[model samples]
Target: MVRIDLKEKEAGTGTDLDSVLAKQRAAFNAHTNPPWSERKANLQKLGKAIEEHAEEFQKAISEDFGNRAYEETTIAELLVIKGGISHALKHTKHWMRARRAPTALQYKPASNRIIPQPLGVIGIISPWNYPLQLAVMPLIGALGAGNRAMIKPSEYTPRLSDLLKRVLGTIFTEDEVYVATGGVKVASAFSALPFDHMIFTGSTSVGKIVAAAAAKNLVPCTLELGGKSPTIIDESANMDTAVARIANGKLLNAGQTCVAPDYVLMPAEKINSFSDAIIEKAESFYPTFAGNKDYTSIIADSHYARLQDLLEDAENKGARIRVAGDDDKQQLAKERRVPLTVVTETTPDMKIMQEEIFGPLLPVVASETLEDSMQYVQSHERPLALYWFGEDKSKREKVLTETISGGVSINETAWHVVQEDIPFGGVGPSGMGAYHGEHGFETFSHMKGVFTQSRFSQGKNLFPPYTDKTRKMLGLMKKIL
Candidate 1:
């Protein structure tokens, strides 16, 4: 049996999360199922708010990260969110419509339909990396499904979180969509709330804690956690193209992305060439690391220290380190940027190989054959995303079938996430549940199966106490079925 472990007050917020939840719940109860027009208006308002506050958000996020690229903020956060809102606005009516389900022959003339209904208040726990996107993407789904929501943005990105709270507050009522800002204590309390549903995006370790807290209230959760997402450069892959694409994905956000290529697996023969090409590619992308506005800084001091520690551990474990771009202490002091470092000669025991390298460090592992590459990925926890670059259709098909991941991109990286039509999520420890576009609507809405019995329905035949006639009827029905 699940238990409720909520506290009277959340330490970080210094407010009663219980009362806040009660307010949202009360509002939702008063207006149970909002009409399509109202939901559409809400979505429109949200999109407008995001557009109006885009610069503010960019500034606040940059402050949070020391030196985030403005274009990265625009492209990765604002544009992606607006696109999602546009997609939701265009298709939400259709998504909300009752889906026709075929009735069985025994229940002929009876109509079956699956109705999607709001799940009341949803709680969102978003991470620091891509704070705006992770927090609002799920909120988009919840709103599209006509559900109210409360968001808890990461404390690490306090400025962005505060900005989000203020911006959202201007457009939405507290009871409609509340942004709760605080540290770990507030996050802990927020996760323990008895929400209708919850969505969390962060590391696997923290995801487990949030899942456990939500489970205490028996609230279903969508966990968008991270793992060692792999990139495989098949023998048939064009080294130049693969190298360029991987470097683009891996270096974007300074490799702080959850779905960034954690490591690379390639055939032994191509290791040296691939390494040289990627280093050159990284250098070309950011001519110099120091004072380069195009390059993003790591989020915090601890994170920067953590990346250095990972490198140190790997090097001590006999892994070779190749640094690309200048390593300037001035840049580190000002922006917290770490130049792209590629590690080779990695073993399974090395911390860099074992842990999710959520920084600008890439470990290139050599595999003797495609089977060896496949075996390496399969042996580890299924990743959130996988990239396989090759022109060979047969090899691509083989990788697609034989390997598993939350999502896949062929001949590219991270682009699969922006495709609004498909579901995006992880398979195992990487995460659970998918939400994007229509999938997002379904995740936040409960699909209730409804059957309207016809006046002449035969469903009653199996409802009463069994008799000889009923038994005969059941047998006949079974034969027909």
Candidate 2:
């Protein structure tokens, strides 16, 4: 009974989501959910399909976002997909095995175990920043946990979503996995659906709305939202390594990544050296970013406008702007690309310092003491990720223990997400719930407890009416048990 809903082609053609949900529910009710072995096989099949269509996926991503680098896309998006599949295949058997539990003495001759069961149909809403990886990663977990899934990719990256649908449709039946494509209306309707579980990856604001919608049906959610993630550089830190790593993380995808170093904290004396090194690194990497075809890209006009607004506001507030390449605003604006600009003498009141600047602008905040820097970060919203660039173990440990974030890295940036064995998620305003490896598989599953008892009877004396002896015996049994 499921059909494609193509009404109003201009609005973006979305599948009949109601029918899709109905079909999934029917499948769930009929106990047709894929077994653990079948789930593993399907995941491996999907991973193989991604590998076969790697070129097409890369091309679609580049076309959608203007200049996504092939190698970067492969490492960030495709490799993560492959890693998820590999992790699932390796751990599916173990994950599906029933876990035994200790039984109390009172329950003699009885055994107990916890069983991991599927949570029926799961809905995944992905963002455009890292569309392919974010969309497929959650699906891998749901599949590994033996659940059907429906994915709704961001409308901003329409071509990539279409390409994903075409590629995935070949490997998976609609009843097993479905990809729904459309604009905001479709996204809203999709969110409102009564899924057993949902995972949404996007801005914190939109994540709130998604959570609200999911709340209506009491659907548990895993929200991957963004916040102003910070990178702390102490005086004892390696200046060269810190600058290089920060520059690389910030400039990737033109600073579109959620975990990209939003700003840096450094001692007053080290500010000049750090800023100089950052500029040098930027030139070596981009050379001529405004005209360079090798460098990646910005999302679109509106995003560029927003970044520009942040820069203009910062500039007007007496902050010195240092451009890595050209300072010609008109030329940069015309190309819809802005050079990596570092803002110094920034205050907490500025818009750039207040909001999560999802762009190429990097603000360098100077701290007189390490305590001041830690306190500064503590005052702000807990970030999705935190990076520390110091060789001193004590200093690093202090920051790690005192400050709170979704995840943290020492001496590097943004590499923690690739580890399939570790959990990746956020806290507070950043997000809620963890997903990536086995943690992701567990998120989409309901752990049910099972117990079996022997037929032997040991309580025949309890059938007698209340008496002095019986009461004393019952009291003694209760105490011993």
Candidate 3:
């Protein structure tokens, strides 16, 4: 069961949104501007808190996800969060440093520089899939960029949210980092609030709603939405290595990851071998997923049902279902457990082929040629991530250069998201804007341009005198310099 703690209500109404916003507004007004050193200190302290609670954070995620592997959680959530913080700490000083710019000829004796400043208070709505990492990492960015924050963690992972609230309470005052916990109603209220900036991580459908609500206030937002990400296995790829990497990535968090390989595209002749290899590798990783403790988890009962429904629908439409583990109904139905399912001979009209299967289901489509596979991906919405496995450098470069995705990986899956140096985000339907490393700090910051000039009159001759001499002088200046 999930436990919630809401602030006491006022007479004749629920908790007051006006009061909460007042507190935030007051805080923002008091600290209208802050120095770079203070922002760096706060960010460093937050990073220390995260490191101190690393074990607790990992355990909370494990409990929430039922059978989440400790190592996987550490790699996927903990390490990613740590890496984001560490990267921010290392480069924030440089990121915050004012950048000098050339003064325009019209503005003589003036010096210009771009200063990255905070956007006051930022609101973050994190999804349940990666509650700990997603929630805290963005906050790190906001704080690093010198902004106050309010976070709304998904109610689906209520336990983790409670833990986060407690942890944050120890390290920060409510004015520094506040947490609001409730169901969808609270989420709606939170999104509707006029935050200086907002960051949302969830499905594209829900993202649309958040975007629409944010539009009311003309609030800037960084949305990280999900889509049907594709993995292409070229003919020159190492079959064994490709299969292992795909299986490892797909089964992590039971495929509840945003960047997990949603579907695979390969030559028609290699489909059978690839499918067999994936099943073999999956069994090797978890001898019995129903009883195996190494494999991670599913979100909840409803999600399990939804995954089953998608599979059933595909099966009813003549798609072949291949199970990597035991297919016993009783075992599968236990709690939120579902075996890794591989679908083949899929048509474009099938629901599974068209939708993002946020479960341990892998869809394999055979294409007549590499171009056919590329065309399939091109036809769909731009994905948050894309993957390719092949030995031919030329072919790999061609795929990478030709395609447009939020991020890409070569010969592996889901590893690009962990590269702290590169920016992580989506484009078009997948998502908008990015946040991680310097990109993250910039997202939460406003680059204000400042110009300083000496009070010297150097262009007195060009003061509104519409003569041929003046025009000729202006033309000469423009052409020469």
Candidate 4:
């Protein structure tokens, strides 16, 4: 067995990324296939650590976000991760077990089975939006697959990143599960490592960079990239219910969610009513922007400024800006908060229409018909999540079959990601692969198919030089297969 003292890894500098990856690779090679008992224990320890430091994590994340609500942190980050851990612990045994597979009639007495084995060291690059969940959710999948992991969290959330490095180090050694902390340089260095598999959760632009970096090493990647997720309001939908649900999903984390509805496409006639209801719903959810604990602040000043720029460009392009919640100018500036602002009368030429609005800015686009809305969605890049609100079964099916996205939440928003049974990921430009629950286990594992042959097997008949007997066998195979 090979080993390296990781005491000097406390700094997690960009310069040491290669050495750290080497150390983790050595540890993973030593235990290529850990038993279910050991994997379960690691998961348990991680869950315990999370539970023990839940409060600290909440506080640290809030400090990073300049006032991320306590409940928001608990619901979106802590609880989601804990739920994933519990789900993984419950199902990992079955996921790890080798399952019997059927053999062909010509190969009777021979049997087949698939053995799921852990990949070597996994590299995880998590985003700043939901720091703890993005970082630990993939970690759960890696550990469950019996793979060692190295995480590089976003630098935007320094407090959470430092806390993650410190807290995770307490339960696992650096070689077992290391946390590399730094800015873009360290992140770039981390992505360039030759790991068995890499998982990155961030924007499409950055995901492209990470994918390119991993491609240089020929490392497979599971990118959870973000795009402009769209929401469709059907003609038959209840305006109140649709608006309320969209509002909740959009305003959560102050609309920093990757799957948040970037824009809404509804019937042209109903746009006014829908916009009114959404504004009212936003106000009801967050009566005031400042001093509102429920309303999460933008993660950083730069992001806040970018959101303002998006709104400004839209307004300059003849879009109407509706401030939903009461604006507290002093508090907004002090805490870097952007109120729930809705942009209507938007055109494709607007900057807000082009980029992923990872903020509290929602653009409501008007569509003449359901077909028109679907056409609009199809014309653009596929999004991470597509939402449709309606009771019409046919229309819902049309949207489902016609549109392609990472996931779909009918009559709802952002709920598809929390279901552990479903594989959560993006499609095309949005993302490439998926991970969650068993899907995650499969992603981190190499499913090796093993075939056992018996002495009486007939497969040997087809492996010889051309002969009358071989021709007869070939004729039989053609008939059966």
Candidate 5:
């Protein structure tokens, strides 16, 4: 029988993780391995709660973002979460089932199997980009795997964070699930907690801090950090389709998405044409920038200023900028709704080129050949996602095999993340580990291998002191006699 092994609890910072975990562990002791039916019911209830309060969540997220697009929230956050829960509920039984394992020929009298067990308690630290989904999606996996959980949502989205506290409180008891909301100190304490497993989604720099804290407790973690993901337009690519898709991915969530295309690598000969096509696509996507309810604003003034600083740094360092439409730059700044601005002739010294560019700014670089482009990608920190826009199978295969990222989108952008079946995460500097679908269930679980020996087996043949008869038998076995 599974039980909470909480021998001692560590002192934490400003957050109440210690107290909350104590309760959760105590509750887990009573209901260690929740039956499949119970787990499924939890997921279904969570899904139902989300649907029931969809309008409230939609309004809260919109207010948090200043003016988030309702449709974007529906498609990106709510619908995606519902789909994830459905997928988890559908295959959780298979994920939890004990599977037969192969035994060696010498162990003919023994049988082997592997069983997946919950890891007690898990902690999830979600970022502000997609606040609700990032926080709850990991919970879906943890609950499905029969593990209790605690969540810490980003403090930047106060409305959403507060709403989640209330809604989650109604759906789940404090022992079953806990949602903590606070600033950096609380995050520090949350990260330092002795969780069975922790998953953090945020910037690479912050992920490093979280990793250090988790290491103190020897806590295994999944870091879904962000880096400057790239989208490459091949020489043989369809410029119209490529530009359209890349713009959609970049502009979504106002380019706050971790998997959004940070920059574009297009042929030097077609940089002008590609930039123009992208400008046209951006205008079509957000026809009215200032008052358009469809376009999302930057999360806060500080982020808005950061984007401005990036633009100034790029422009001062001799990068060319193209406005998507006839929008007033000053007014856009005041309103926190920066339109899709494409930068060309970008150099490494520019801030946009140096950073993740988590805004609606696209840096289009000139690459002479695909090999050169791949080389440039390799030289930097590995990114969370890479988008290659081309129809050539050979070229695509070369890029796929030659380079590595957490995930990739062939001839498209940003769609690989919501697929549910594949593991989504990062590599090297971008981040570590993956989650989603069955991979997610396993991430929060431990696969214990079991071996059973037959009672009437010939096990005594090899258990005694070394003798002439045993030596002879060993020799005969070695020679296959």
Candidate 6:
């Protein structure tokens, strides 16, 4: 059985950010670079706690979001985090191994090694969407690398954040893991803390603020920010499969996913057909959106209103927008639900096209040619993810090579972010740095480079300015190496 520290933790864990960081830093000092077995044990205990308390988390997130689908919380948040824990535990030993590097000829009998050491303390700032998963996933990496962590969950998801604090308090000492909650002020304060490493997952605009704050402390950060991820449907694509995948990714959290295809690029002639297919696919998937348990709702009045403004702005600018249950705006509004909106005839001047549309608004832009689609992607800041749907091997390879994104899901969408073996991150405005699986372990680690030299080696021969022997050695190296 995994250990759950049953001692009652003190209240106000979410209030004092400075105390949390100081306590965690002290804890890290007490236990610097914990053994692989301990790290593995930590991950196991977390996984066990999660497995036992999954339903509570699901319910808390549901409450926090007004109506986030329970199944989404289960599949996207809980299950995915469980997978991360398992992966980290399994591979931590190998990840902890010091790698020996080759030495230069001049440094005969000398060797170098790269040792991965735990950063003293890590700070994680997770977004409201997929709150539990985003917060805990990075914690997995920090613990797997033997670093104490302080997580600042989003202000929007108060219930989930509180639950996370309570749940984690039961399982871990505050120093080992802490959750601090508040609105923008608390978040700003948390960002200014002198953490060893910081990870922020949210919008690019806020990421900049976090980055600036972290920079003042000279703390390195991994920014998992949002952008307009594109999904391209080629002429040779299987229309139905493409539509289904896009629908799944976009509608996962009522289109709140950072990696959801913000826009669709397809051949101009196939625009109407693709739009029709997506509307049909969305309807078939969730026959009733607003009152449906399978469908998630907008978390706040502000976000819901923002989505409305985006829709109105798009329509006013001449985009054809279709909601899931067309003509049920009244019902949708009552539930804080916005259906999958397939938008076409979109232009760059529109609000939906300019900003990262964090709702179920798909801006379908007509691409006259494959070059046009690729060029369109290039014109903007790199995306968090890029999806291409087609079987043409050469075209697929071209798209992969020509475009840049944080990740890619060829013929699919959003699923690539969960891979334990790979790094998940973004580029340019999308964000920077990556963390997942062993990559996460490394990201939170300080890879200290160590060089060892044999006492009797000739390394000291070149220590002085102008020795004949040093000249000979340098000449030989230049000629041979």
Score each candidate by Cα lDDT: 0.89, 0.86, 0.84, 0.89, 0.89, 0.88
**Per-prediction TM-score, please?**
0.96, 0.92, 0.94, 0.96, 0.94, 0.96
Residue-level lDDT of model 3, residues 1-481, one tens digit each, is 3344432231101245545666776887898766768877787777788778877877888787777777877888878887887787788888888899988776667688998988988999999999988998899889888888989898777778888888887888878888777677778888888889999999999999999999999999999998988999988888999999999889888899999999999877888888898999988888887756677667777788789889999999899999987656787577567767899988888889988999889999988777888888898899999999999998888888888899999999988887877889999999999988888888999999898866783465577756776787688678757
Q: Which segments of candidate 6 are over 4 A away from where they belong?
A: 1-15
Write one digit per residue (lDDT tens) for candidate 4, span 1-481.
1122233345466668888888888887887899999999999999999999999999999888878888998999888998999999999999999999998877679899999999989999999999999999999999999999999988888778889999999999989999988776678789999999999999999988999999999999999998999999887888788888999999999999999999999766777777788888888887888878878888877788898899889999999999876676777878888877889999999999999999889899989898999999999999999999999999999999999999999999999999999999999999988999999999999999999989887767777676888899889877888
The Cα error of candidate 2 at residue 264, in Å, is 1.0
Worst lDDT run of 10 residues, candidate 3, spans 5-14
Candidate 1 clash pair list:
none
Q: In angstroms, how far off is 360's CA in candidate 6?
A: 0.9
Looking at model 4, report the run of 10 residues with the lowest lDDT sum. Answer: 1-10
Encode model 5's per-residue lDDT on 1-481: one tens digit a residue. 1121221122234445898998998888888888899999999999999999999999999988888988899999999999999999889988989999997656667899999999999999999999999998999999999999999888788788878988999989999988887777778889999999999999999999999999999999999998999888888788788988999998999898999999999778899988898888899988879878999999888889898899999999999999787877677877799889999999998989989989899999999899989999999889999999989999999999998899999988999999999999999888899999999999999999999997865556777896777787677567753
- Cα deviation at 100, candidate 2, in Å, is 1.2
Which digits, one per residue and each the tens of the lDDT, describe model 2 over residues 1-481? 1122333253334357878888887887787456766887888898999999999989988877777788889888998899889988998779888899997776667788998988999999999999999999999999999888999998778778888989988998887788888777889989999999999999999999999999999999999998999999887887888889999899888899999999998877777777888998998988887656666667778888888889889889988888898646676676677778888888777899999998879999988777998998899899999999888888888999999999997889898877888888999899999998889988998888998876773455466786777787688779977
Candidate achieving higher lDDT, 1 or 5: 1
User: Who is ahead in TM-score, 3 or 6?
Assistant: 6
Model 6, 220-304: lDDT tens digits are: 9999998999998998889989999999999999999999889999877888988888888999988988788888998887889
Per-residue lDDT of candidate 1, residues 1-481 (tens digit): 1122332243235357888889999999999999999999999999999998899999998878878889999989999999999999999999999899998887789889999999999999999999999999999999999999999988788778888988998999889999888776788888999999999999999999999999998999999998999998887888889989999999999999999999999866777778888999999999988788888988888888889889999899999999896667675646688888889988988899989989889999989878899999999999999999989999899999999999999999999998889999998999999999999999999999998989987667777787777898889888879
Model 2 scores worst on lDDT over the 10 consecutive residues at 1-10
TM-score: the better of candidates 2 and 3: 3
